[model samples]
Structure formats: structure tokens, C-alpha cells
Target: MRFKLRPSDDAFYEFFSKAAANLVRGTELLNELALPGADVQSISERLVEVEHDSDAITHELYNKINTSFITPFDREDIYRLGSQLDDIMDHLEGVGSLLYLYGLTKLPSLPREVHEMVNVLDQQAKLTADAMPRLKSMKDLREYWVECNRLENEGDRVYRMLLVRLFSGEYDALTVLKMKEVADELEAACDAFEHVANTVETIAVKES
Candidate 1:
């Protein structure tokens, strides 16, 4: 076991856990978009609400970092982790908003690979939510970042396949453009999750 002289600031850990849980909610909303005859506008609105909640949590965390003399880890790391988590939510909201705005929901169905991308994000979100609470101990975190990287690679593959499907004369030119934008946001969310994991790995290494 490793030991360090750090304050017993559970609030920082709580903030992280809350933000991660919010991510789980965001991904769940995104998954609803994959269902048949799903209501895109409602999901988009709920996602926006969840994104706002994440923003509030991040704001509170930043304020905590400013007021607290001692933090669980580097203050910068805490902020980066919070920002990265928020970035994921932003991308999620973008996915929903793009679907509604571009009227992509009117299609009979979305490509299978797009849902695969959502599945990857859903896994990442749950993994992150599970890992954030463990930051208080900084134990068993190696699996989190490792698996997150693997999932990101998987998401990349799905994204590439989605683009191929999008551009293979399957969709109209304008529709392809709209879906590509949404795909970009989904891929970005996958990368953002990896960024959070990488930051957590960094904090664990520094404290170890």
C-alpha cells in the first residue's frame, strides 16, 4: 500500500463520482436514440438537462479547488478530469441535438455501426462511473484506464466503418453530411472518455 500526507477531502471524490454518474445518465439517453421510433427531440432535451447538471457539478468542483488549500491530488489534475468529463457530456448532447436538428430521426433506421459506437460509449461511461469512486483509494485503477483505451480503439474502428457506410452511396449527400457531424461528436466523446482515464492514470502514478 502507498501512503501520502493529504487532507481527508471526501468532497473532491464525491464531486468526481457525481460527475461520472451524470455521464452514465448521458450515455443512457444517447442509447435511447438507437431504439426504433424513438423520440429524438425528447431525448435531446433530456440530454441538454443532463449536460447542464454536469456543468453545475464541474463549476462546484472548480470552486472547491479554489477554496480548498489541500486536494486529494494535484489541483490541475482535478480540473482536467472535471473538464474532460464535461467534454464527454457536451459531445453526447451534440449527438442528440444533431440528430434532431438535421432530421436524421426521420429515417427508417440508422446504420448498425452507429449504434455500435453508442454501445462503446455506454461501456466507457459505466466503467468511468465505477472507477471514479475508487479514486479515493487509488487502487484497482489500472484496469480502468487499460479497458478505457481498449474501448476507445474499438470505438475508432466502429467510427471508421460508420463513415464507410455513410459514404458508400447509401445515404444522400446532405444526409451523409449531417450524420458525419453526429459521428464526429460520438467519436469525440469516446476520445474524451479516454482523456479522463489518462488523467486518472496520471494522478494514480503521481500519488504512487
Candidate 2:
């Protein structure tokens, strides 16, 4: 193990935790837009604000990385974790953008599978946020990454089912295309969360 003479900066952890909180807000707003008679434009506006806030947090994190001589974990891990978290928010914002751009009046009673996928995104964001504070000790963090892997796997199965239904003559070709786009964004968001969890696990192992 490489020993550090200087104390590592811990501000990155606080930034990460703040970013995760913003991500949860983004997902929650996206999920709200999925409800009946939801104001898609208004919710998208709110998400835009959340996305901007997250971008600011990300900028601060990278600035910290560049200035600090010592980091709480590996430098590349810091970059990847911050980038993945930003991607999750970006995709959540994409979901809202698609709703408005597609002129979808209301998400037709989304299949249970699709709802489950959104639920997983919400849970994953909150779990990641909760785990960020534990980075100091790197203790009891295995469950977070393990749960992330399981949720990503579950999201994959649901995504496949969604595609099959999209092509099964249940929706017109145009409608199928639009719904598929939304599903793609949601799946990408879940994948982003999994990537964050993987990075955290790697950092923990190295630090431990």
C-alpha cells in the first residue's frame, strides 16, 4: 500500500453525497411525470434546474480533484464516480424531455415491468446517497454494490420484456418508437447507477 504523508481531502465525499441527492430529486420528478395528467413541461423545467445544479456539483468535485494533492480514493475512481452520477441525472432529464418532445399526453398505463424499473432507479439513487457518507471507513458497503448489481440485472429483464411488447402489435409503429425511447433512457439511468456502484466497490476494495 502506498502511504500518504498528507491527510487526504474529504470534501469530495460531501460533493458526492450532494450529487446523489440531486439525482434522487431528478428521478423522483421523472417518476412524477409518469403519473396521469402530470404536467410534463413543468416537471421537465424542474428537472432542468436539478440537472443544472448537479452539473455545478460535478464541476466543484473536479475542481477539488485538480487542486488537492491527496484524495480520499484513487483519482480515476473519483472521476468515474462523478461522471457516472452525472450521467444518471442526464438520463433522468432525458426521460422528461422525451415526454414533452413526443407530445405524449399521458404515459399509457405503463406495464408493471416498466414501473418496477423506475422504482429500482429511485431506490438505487437513495441507496447510493446513503452510502456516500460511509466512504470514510469503507465499512459495511458491500451490500450497496451487491444490491446495485441485482437491481441492474432485474432492470435488464424488464427492459427486454418492454421491447418485446413494444414490437408485439400492441402499439402502432410510431408509438412503439416513442415508448422505446423512454424505456431506453430509463434503462440507461439504471445502468449509470450500476456503474457508480461498481466504481464505489472498486474504490472500497483498494482502500481496504
Candidate 3:
């Protein structure tokens, strides 16, 4: 251990960020069933896999946050950041679970559109992770975070349009409901990402 080392606050942000990236990858993997031979089994199996991955990262980050003597922001912010980042993975897990529970043997192209939104969420997570260190300079990166918010807003737009398309579709009520549930979760995950961005921005202001 070096004496008088600088505190590394971004670890809290970075660990959860791996958690976030896996969440998007998990969604994309499942959504790949939008093609052939992709069924409920694939979704369920992937869900379990991602759940284990996400949970491990969350626990590790939580431990790091609690044990570390230094963080750039308040302890509560650290906790909130970890939880919110983990939440995106949780939402993706929910989507996979719903696929199994709803008995959706086949995937649809429309949900793929929302999956595209996950890519936006991916960018949000990256921006957030990048911006946390910016807390060291987060003041200078407020506009950078605002851009992440814009991505979240775009996610909101995609969710709304997906819902509209779901209702307009020829699918049955249960199908519509399942689609709605998936979209809600994806949208909520994106919202949670925005919350992380907002938290980062706030921390930047207070620290600066």
C-alpha cells in the first residue's frame, strides 16, 4: 500500500458500468431471438446468466463503496449509483422472465426497436461512467450529461411509439400486455440511467 494515495471514487461508477453494459448485451442476446429457432428457452437461460453476472458486480461494487475510505461523492450517492446501475440489469432480467412467463415462443420485430433503444442506454451508461471521473471535472461536463439526458428522452420517445404500435397490432390482449410490460421495463431502465446522470451532475455541482 502506497502512503497518501489519492482516492479513486470512479470505481463505484465503473463497476456498476460493467453491470450496465452486460444488461444491454443481455437484451441484445435475447432480442436476437427476433430471428429463427430463438424461443423461450434461450431467453430464460440468458436471463439466469445475466442475473448472476449483474448481481456479482453489484455486490462487489457495494462492498467496495462501503469499505473504501474515499469516494468523490457522498456515501448515499455511491449507494444510489450502484443500485440504479444494477436496476438496469434487473429490468432486463424482468424482460427475459416475462418472455418465459408470458409463453412467448417467438420474438417480434417491434421489440427489436426498443432493443435499439438499449444501445442508446448503452451510450448513457458509458457517458455516465465517463462523467463520474468528470466529477473531478463534472462541472465542465454538464452539457455532456445533458446529452445523456437527451438520449434518455429519445428512449422515452421510442417506448411511447412502441406502445402505440403494440396497441395497433393484430396481437391479442395478453400479447399486448406482455409487450407493454417489456417496454415499460426498458423505459424504466433508461430512466434509471438518467437518474444516474442527474446524480453525477448534482455531485459535480456540489463538489465544484
Of the candidates shown, which would achieve the greatest lDDT relative to the real structure?
A: 1
Which regions of candidate 1 deviate over 4 angstroms? Answer: 1-3
Q: Compare candidates 2 and 3 on lDDT and give the better one.
A: 2
RMSD of candidates 1 onward, in order: 1.0, 1.8, 4.3
Off by over 4 Å in 2: 1-8
Query: Clashing residue pairs, candidate 2?
Result: none
Q: Any residue pairs clashing in model 3, and if so which?
A: 134-137, 134-138
Cα shift from native, residue 4, model 2 (Å):
6.2
Instruction: For model 3, state the Cα shift of residue 193 in Å.
Output: 1.3
Error of 1 at 180 (Å): 0.4
TM-score of decoy 3: 0.77
- Off-target runs (Cα >4 Å) in candidate 3 are 1-6, 9-14, 105-116, 126-140
lDDT (C-alpha) at residue 83 in model 2: 92
TM-score, every prediction? 0.98, 0.93, 0.77
Question: Against the true structure, candidate 3 has what lDDT?
Answer: 0.71
Best by TM-score: 1
Whichever of 1 and 2 has more lDDT, that candidate is 1
